[model samples]
Target: MSYEKRPDGRNFDELRPIEAKVGVIKNAVGSASFKIGKTWALAAVYGPRELHPKFLQDPAKGRLRCNYNMMPFSGTGDRIRPGGNRRAKEISMVTEKSLMPVLDLKNYPNTVVDVFIELPQTDAGSRCAGICAASMALADAGFVMKDLVSAVAVGRVDDKIVVDLDYQEEAYEDGPVADIPIAMLPRTKEVTLLQMDGEISKEQMAEALELAKKSVDEIYEFQKKALKEKYTGEQNE
Candidate 1:
């Protein structure tokens, strides 16, 4: 049974409705919130402050650290245990790497910039949402960056290539499913992160990349708008 119709009825190249905003957290140096469908991620940025361990400090550049956490009750499936898990650790590492290409921390030598991403509710795409939120929060914190990163999941859902896969598509049982999460520099179209969960053909990979690139462009617009609204004093949804 080849998957034909999307569970949510979105077009093959379509994404779930998205919402974004900056300055959502009061005490943090900077913060942003991003929501796509049922998935929601909040990111807070702190520091450019001194790195605590003396040996870990870099004389020429600052370091960026990211922590990703999904609240125990956040998932649409089973309850997640509170505290760090292997999945959280892996996602955290990837999220940091995804946002690193655009940032320039040279001036803030010996310091560390921390980004914390918390998902209060999710319906898949949590890691992508976290990366999106973290990027906005970093920009909001006045970090020097070449560009903002935008991320989304694009892959083969059974027989159809799709963008912004939801929970149902990821768990599609009738046929093969490939869930690929990609992060990119929208202005330059440079892929910073690409991870695939299932097998895909070369032709399918190329097609998926194309879809991801186009989708990130749309996500980029949302990110830019949110940042602009924050500084321009415009209300954002």
Candidate 2:
């Protein structure tokens, strides 16, 4: 998950170009397509619907479950296996955790919200992209939230801290490298997700956290713009 600590010619704080669109799926309550550099994820929201599975249902609040998938052909050179695997499920769980704190679940009693994010293409940091896309999708579904969540990843490259690690930068494996992904509720400035892979000193972790928080503001702006473009465009309004 960590990249080699090399300069790699990328600006330390630069993020990969992101493209986002909402209402991409007409059938879903809400849908979004998101891309960061070469990685792409499509997210759709369905529900506040009746809960079918009895065990997963809650009486006082709407329950939520997430599904994440990476297509077999998402990778280059070789094909990956299709269908839900352990990795996919795990990502779904972490993603659900990150989004859980912000939702006003109790508002929709005896209902369930289903969010699905599919990665048709990926290089790295697809999970982070998923978090961003999922939040927008939920908003599109008209879910109540305290604040929209924004997410990005930070890492140590070439012994220096970097923000938004790209595929090449992330794939680097010369020595010990650390990957730290972060997500926050931007309005409250509260972090909901913080994941670290590999080892780094406390000082390094602090620095990475600082960078992640600052970069989240940029991602948040993109999220707002995407929503506005969908709901506030000339023809949309």
Candidate 3:
């Protein structure tokens, strides 16, 4: 089987059209929505506020907490409970790790930064889209950061490496391979989160990382454009 088969006639490194919006929710301190192909996610940021007594608090710097959940009808095949399960918890942790590196946590002491991600549609790259949305929401909240963070997923299908896998592609592909999801600080080109599933040769891994880095660069542009539009609207009023 050839992993290099092109779906939708896009090149190996090509990304689906990305649409992003900020401040979609009126109540949240900040919010953003992002779509990659059919996968859609909304992220909200609320805080640099007091932490609950039961939750762990950071003494030296503000704490970052993340929650990720999918709506019951998000996937095509079946509905899921609209709450955090083990997978959601793990994704949240990974997202937090991905975002922390870019945050200036010490700037806001004795507080907590809460990020929530809601997926209304599921595709292979939803996790990456969620991370991008969260980063934009934090920026909308007026949080200072070193640089914007963005994520993308690269997968091996039929012996070819592809960037931003869709649900259909991910499900049917076969091979000894790797699916690498990565978050990066765009300005500094620093990695904040990295996760991989399956096995690949060293050469293949290197190629995937190269593809991921390029994808991040593309995502950063989309993030900037989305942020500009949000603030532009506010300023015009």
lDDT of 3 by residue, 1-237 (tens): 666566677888999989988989889999999999889999999987898783577778999999999889998887887677999999999999888888888976778889989999987788899999999999999988778899999877767888987877777645555677888887777888888887777787788888888899999999998899875775233
Candidate 1 regions with alpha-carbon error over 4 angstroms: none
Among these predicted structures, which one has the highest lDDT?
Answer: 1
* Candidate of highest TM-score: 1
Error of 1 at 119 (Å): 0.3
Q: Candidate 1's C-alpha lDDT?
A: 0.94
Q: Which of candidates 2 and 3 is the stronger one according to lDDT?
A: 3
lDDT of each: 0.94, 0.85, 0.86
How many pairs of residues collide in each model? 0, 4, 5
Ten contiguous residues minimizing lDDT sum, candidate 2? 1-10
Task: Flag the better candidate by TM-score, 1 or 2.
Answer: 1
Q: Which ten residues in a row have the lowest lDDT in candidate 1?
A: 228-237
- Would you list the clashing residue pairs of candidate 3? 2-158, 3-157, 3-158, 3-159, 3-160
Tell me how far candidate 1 lies from the true structure as C-alpha RMSD in angstroms.
1.3
Q: Which ten contiguous residues of candidate 3 have the minimum total lDDT?
A: 169-178
Q: Write the per-residue lDDT of candidate 2 for residues 192-217, one digit (tens) a residue.
A: 88888777888988898888888888
Model 1 Cα shift for residue 166 (angstroms): 0.7
